[model samples]
Target chain A: MVAPDYLQVLVLAAVAIALIIVTIEVVARIVRPHAPNPNKYETYECGERTIGSTGVKIGVQYYLYALVFIIFDVEAVMLFPWAVSFKEFDGVLGLGTIIFAEVFMFVGILLIGLVYAWKRGVLEWQEM
Target chain B: MVDLMNWAGIYDTIEGFLSGLGLSFIIPLTLYAIAALILFGFVAALVLVTTYLERKILSDIQVRLGPMETGGRRFHGILQPVADGIKLLQKEDIMPKNRDKLPYYLAPLVVFVPVFVIMGLIPLGFIPLDIASLNKNLLVAADLDIGILAILALAVIPTLGAVMAGWSSRNKFTTLAMLRSVAQGISYEIPFVLAALAVVLAAGSMNLSEIVKAQSGLWFIFLMPIGFIVFFMAALAEIHRIPFDVDEAENELVSGVIVEYSGMRFAFFYLAAYAELFIAAALITILFLGGWAGPVLPGVMWFFIKCFVIIYVIIWMRGTLPRVRIDQMLAVGWKVMLPLALLNLLITSSILML
Candidate 1:
């Protein structure tokens, strides 16, 4: 119940260090051909050879999808669990239900925003 | 737990160390082993069944008959996993030519281990088991103080494996898919973590049980609507399913990071994908649904029902919604979500402080 005691932290840190060493060792062993092909090292994040200049940048439509993702993602995680617990804590006190209802209202507002975005074509797929 | 750890001598060394570790540790370790084995066998079966059900349900939504080809007896497709196991067993495993054999071989294990560990953090169902005539808490393996952190920390590995798998394959499609996966993972993870942070703030403990307990009066979702929305979306993205699955976009990336994998190696990725889905789903249940908190049914049933329902939603959407563009996906993470998450955290903190 207390924050993992010092010993636990030390053990965890040790595990982390071991994992790092293991990673380095694995990488060293795996990179076989000693020839430094200047192109090979630049893969993905390491900026390897141009992988067709990545994907073309789309406009606000991309932003909108991510926004909606955030919106719906939060909705699913929070509300479903709340629904389960609300049924449990229910017993004459209308307070929890009222709070839950208020959340539904918030979701209602977001839906309105979504509809607005939909109408404004914010979520529409556009050619970049 | 210390006693449990003393019992945790490496399995390879078990035979030699058996008499040396003393019977005191042996007795408890034996009990722990039995309990763990039972738990594993049960969950493994559940994973298989849950997978079959997801496939069946998703197929039904798409108006396709699923697993009918396998059963040969009027949708008796429950035997599918058995058939799959046999086929995987019979097939020869192949390593990609340019792959790192060690981590490449380790990818599946890395993918699964995180999932197995996170199971402990979730308050699915606990059984009371006797060890050395002691009533030990048999529900979970080890319930850490930072329970949610334990889950999140372990959850990050599968994406790395996908990246490693892609890189090792030396395939263009996989590398592209993995790049998208990395972006998806990092983006979704930020919101998920922030959302968890919000819940932890409200609950005042990382222990999932304690968080569930905090909601005895009210669930955090009611107080923090934005938080719930952000969290669930992030969870969906984390699993790389349906709407957020541009990483594996079949038409675009052509099987993406897993294009080159086949046979049992592919099965490992498939199993890992489903496992990741449940692990994330279970976390959502624990964090927001009130871990094991429900009326009429026992906590585990309610927990599972809620989980299947969410999983069903993912399956449903897969057949319903068209995949979103990748950059748009990132935009959602940064432009909209990051801001909303910050606001939700701010509001929740202010409320708790007051």
Candidate 2:
């Protein structure tokens, strides 16, 4: 109950932050100068007028990094509960060794995935 | 209800004072407002101090006077941040032509709110004057069961804001910067989480206050030096501090994802960056340097002292180290930091088993 109540406080904190940002923006809007020119709205490319469409193709290497990130992110999440309860396992008879081995195996497989990604050049951000 | 009040010392006092006036019904709402105000003020003050210190320290490092004209030459420009903030508030809010509309307007808010929420989760040590004789961590807004996890989870969110800013701006530089930011952010987060996980394994608790309490004898930094280094490096990268700020490489990306933002919206990103810096420093203190644990000084003082020291190191790196290329940044994150963190976790867990 206390934890949930504290969570409510967390939500309240978030709401407060949003409100503060909005308040600042609204005040700024009222007080700040506004002299909008078409030239000022031009896309900034080191003060050079941007040539052609601003819609550019990003390298696919970014997607590869994201894909690899997800796999390891899930591994990290799975390890969280095990890491928190790791000491508790030590108190029981042989549970420590069993869980340790299981985690090792689980993480070992992920490490292999990481290595595979490295070998396949997924980790390398090749210049496109 | 009584138990809840007892845990929050100041909240209890305020509630009691209200109830004495037959106003118990409004206590919860009043406390919530007060808590929110306190947190906001704390974060705002932190940003101001850190920003000023950063300029002063960087100037010292580079052998120059920083901000002497703004506050006063005698006081060394202490009021410069306040002046800068007011100036920023009065700047024209620029809206780009042909923008995506929604994400552009929402990007700064998305970037700022998560970082602000993270400050609430950080345990800033107990109330030194324990008026109620209750040994509760009254400083942290939410002492969640998954405190560390929650912090880490919240840490990864600002990248979405960067991406939104980049893509929605209809600027090529921002789009490219957004791609690099996402890749870099996600890559460094692994090692950061793993390094924190190593500490969790040692402390056997995800709650940050519990982690600090577990370190009463010896700090985890000594027990697992690799974890500390990895965490610190990954954190530097995660927060986009220099030597790892490729996404914001001003020469290349023209301010990167925030290239298009102006005025108050721009200030949101600026505030968020400083706030993330504070949170990262606080996390380092809590995870490695032993949060709020020190001699002579009070726990709150010790906590802040440790945080500022880490912040000093971060700013020093910013002044000294050259930014790495995006390719090199990703390579270091994936190839080097991740394996080191996993090794730290394996060693810590194995040692615990023994």
Candidate 3:
């Protein structure tokens, strides 16, 4: 089956953007000066000679935050369908309250997780 | 309601004209080409105007004349952004030694493409003149069902590009900057989505145009002021604007994940930033400010008027506020904004139920 009109337009738009980027880059590559020097290739270090490896270990605190973010992000995703259909449910008897309560329990559990992270100092940024 | 000029009617007229010439087979292609051109031109113009406006506004705030030399003295450097674009196009492209060649080359494209795609999802304005046509919006490329969700989902891709740029650069500062940006981006995003969810709950639709239509009687800003504030603050952080721009703290990280890029690649990052800024402002206009809704003026005109006002406020904040510390930024996102967004959601849902 053929894709819907909007999807077709979206794909066409994406292609057009890719074409624009390519054309611009190609023109720039042709017109721009090309002189490569060793000094220019070196990483910028604010005038000081670079020392040590670039892959320095960061605080594990970031990873912990990422973990928490994943949980909340999922919660947000799950909440969208309910949020959209809420009006329909509200028009029906008894169903609106049930759906609202279910979402409340779901979000409440996630909020508890967030609070747990907060209490555990997982949200705190530890300076390295 | 006053009858506004209908883009959909014009589109159908064009399609019929083409069909009369026995060009019906190429109609879709032609329409798509036209849509792409209009969208690109609009976004490019927005970037140019906003860049110049930003400099002029910041300069005025600092009691200085900005961009008086470009274009002509009479135009007050109106052509400054154009000059900058041409200069960047002709600048030398630099690649650092021992960098990850693939991602280094691909990073800018990754950062840019999603922003362009998100532009397609925005309903610029509405004209109810074409009752027969599928879309009534002025010039939206795709009025998708999951409009806001698609926008939010696509918005996350650029952060990946930032991380890739930082990691591939083989530079300490870039890595640190990307990490900070990732932390900040993810932190702000929760409240942003939650705040937007409050709007969705109130409007009872995920489609952006419908959300705008829902605000016909009363704008969501009046109904949920806390949600608007939370969304706006979270949006500022998401775009890495000043006061929430710790990642690109020039005095510290030396231009953040983009430190090593030069020429057109560097230009891509700036273009993406401006495009995202426009999207944020437009989203605020659509979600909270009764998009395209006003007396007398056409919907498209009103939509843009609201957008520019919001954009001006953003620029004013940039001129006024200092960058918050990274810790403070995260604390605001998580501790303050997140709870407030949740509370807003709770209140909105309860009110709707009642």
Q: Candidate 2 residues B1-354, lDDT tens each?
A: 222345657676887799999999867667666666677788889999999999999999999988998867889988999998898889887878878999998898888888888887888887777465454545776677888998898888899999899999988889888888888899999999999999999999999989999999999999999999999999998999899988988888888899899888888899899999999999999999999999989998999999999999999999999998888888999999999998998899888877
Each model's DockQ?
A: 0.05, 0.67, 0.65
Question: What lDDT is reached at residue B90 by model 3?
Answer: 94
Candidate ordering by DockQ (highest first):
2, 3, 1
lDDT of 1 at B231: 94
Clashing pairs in 2: none
lDDT of 3: 0.86
Candidate 1, residue B241: how far the Cα is off, in Å = 0.6
User: Per-prediction count of colliding residue pairs?
Assistant: 19, 0, 0
The stretch of ten residues in a row with the least summed lDDT in candidate 1 chain B is B127-136
Tell me the deviation in Å of residue B4 in model 3.
14
- Please list the Cα RMSD from the true structure of every candidate, rounded to 1 decimal place: 9.7, 2.7, 3.2
In candidate 1, which residue ranges exceed 4 Å CA deviation? A1-128, B1-36, B69-75, B126-138
Give the share of true interchain contacts found in each model. 0.00, 0.68, 0.64
lDDT of 3 by residue, B1-354 (tens): 001123336557767899899988866666666666667777788899999999999999999999898889998999999999999899998889989999998888888888888887888886545565343434477777788988999899999999999999999899989999999999999999999999999998888989998999999999999999999999999999998999999899989999999888898888889999999999999999998999998888998899889889999999999889999888888899989999999999898888
Q: Assess the local accuracy of residue B224 in candidate 2 as a C-alpha lDDT between 0 and 100.
A: 97
lDDT (tens digit, per residue) of candidate 3 on A72-114: 9999999999999998888865588899899999989989998
